[model samples]
Target: MPLVTSRRFFELGDTVWARWYSARKETWELGTIKEKVGSKMYKIFIIKYEATCIRHIDQLLKFTGNDNSLKINNTDNVESRNFQSLPLLPSMPVNAPLSEPSVSNLRSSTIVEQPVNTDAIDHGNGEEWGDYSAQDSVGDSTKIPEASDSPEASENGVEQP
Candidate 1:
């Protein structure tokens, strides 16, 4: 009998940590192997407990559970690299019924990673002016600006000759 060299060996209902790509980058998230779509493609249900996604065999790295070299299963630690950082929800069932959260059930969301201005202005009147982030969002627009769409409007939105 020859030693198996496959980087990973997973099946349906197996709770494995698969690599999921969002946008262009990669994220090693906790997921369940829902179905083997083909010879290589696999449909995975993300345990972020949200959307379902698909990945290829090469993309599915083996989940090496701990640094002690004690793996959860035989095929888990057969990979080259040690993936001790891979998160898992062992107590959670791989085939557990999913309940998709509605939009209203979700909390307020915002996108980050935008450029932040390092130069913050201090007005000295107990006020600091700087770029507002989604987390510590500045208050909403204090007052709505009067419409200045009319062609005859002047600099101050006043009618001009």
Candidate 2:
């Protein structure tokens, strides 16, 4: 019976061969593990490329040297080390309620709104002006004057009130 040993994870700072793809060809590059970014994932610094990249455990192969000190002895009971899974992004409240800022809260203390010069504002075309609450009625100048007020109305024998 042959014994099979599996190296499930690599430690930070361990030298490993990282898989690289170039022009449809798969190549292996030497890299040093720099960080454990996620479950079964690591950040490695590729020596040849002088660049750091994230890779999964399946993409990395541990480098064992002739020095006996660097070799990890395989054991039948060997288990993979448990690593804490770091969050890639800050956790946000899943069901946080969104709201519009109140008018008072939105107003800035530095912004002082100047009083509008309502009296100096021209309503245009010498027309009668009224307060903001003004509305159109039968006699209101702002309303289109009824045809009864026209000089042509007198010619038509329509009595002017």
Candidate 3:
């Protein structure tokens, strides 16, 4: 059989590192193959940029978790890029049921009531203000004065009809 130049390499939902070239720089960003546009072309959803774009087979690299060199460092400065080689594994599975904390584990404490020192407060003026209770707040919301239907009272003798 002869060598096939055009072939489908990536499948839908396959994680890949896509090569993105801009006017200023060229960087490889992690993404997943969303759709197969052509035999060798595919539409991928970029994870870093949160965008979808069409890419050729040459622009795509399958992320099989083996090629450590090809993996993007998620940082601009390569010298200062410090990250663990392996991903952190959780002690327990996320869907696992959580155990309730027992009453013995909880600490019991007595709430001490402190006396208020009103003398420390500086009342701007020598006059002492009366305590405003719930009743005082309710009484403050009085009916607003509306314009009277009667003719306007004027200091001058000139009256409006």
Candidate 4:
């Protein structure tokens, strides 16, 4: 008889693992399964078992309780039974919500770099720049009014006016 292939679902705790493999191979591992839903489809599944080695082959036969000849006859049915047994397995509750990545405490762990000398530098032209400084005022604001409005004695080579 021609070999038949079918879809099978297995439950590993709370998660579901699906695969399609021939039992005749004497061992089967969880291999990836791809389904075409529409024009564009994408999904990833992990294979949890491999039977290329003699040890693995023995292990697989032990798990399925079937030899190569028997496997060829009931490969599809065996897979179906394996799928149904998944839900019966006890699944632990997920402590953290899937939407939350469980790393909220790490969000504020970044280091901030601050400029050490934030104050403006003085160019030393006797004029102070930037907001709020004593040197910013001009036109004799620093000198007291002389006794007379007329020009006083010229000092320091400054022209009196």
Residue-wise C-alpha lDDT for candidate 4, range 5-85, written one tens digit per residue? 533332222122322233222222322223333232223232333222112111211123222222222234333224222
Residue 135 displacement in candidate 1 (angstroms): 55
Flag clash pairs in model 3: none
Clashes of each: 0, 0, 0, 1
Q: Which regions of candidate 4 fall more than 4 Å away from where they truly are?
A: 1-14, 25-42, 50-85, 88-161
> On a 0 to 1 TM-score scale, where does candidate 3 land against the true structure?
0.39
Which candidate leads in TM-score? 3
How are the candidates ranked when ordered by lDDT, highest leading? 2, 3, 1, 4
Residue 78 shift from truth in candidate 4, angstroms: 17
Give per-residue CA lDDT, model 2, range 76-151, as digits (tens).
Answer: 1112211111112254212111232235544335867999878756588444344332343244555566788888
Residues 5-108 of candidate 1 have per-residue lDDT tens digits of: 75546878666566665544355665678899987889987656456889887656445454344343435522533445453456532322123234564466
lDDT of 2 at 82: 12
Cα distance off (Å), candidate 1, residue 152: 43
Please report, in order, the local distance difference test score of every candidate based on alpha carbons: 0.58, 0.60, 0.60, 0.32
| TM-score result, candidate 1 | 0.36
- Where's the lowest-lDDT run of ten residues in candidate 1? 92-101
Model 1 scores what on Cα lDDT? 0.58
Q: Candidate 3's residue-wise lDDT over 1-161, tens digit each?
A: 98867553987988776766543445565678999998889999876566898999977766655434433445533333222222223752222112323456567689999997776454675344345444555566775443442345344344544
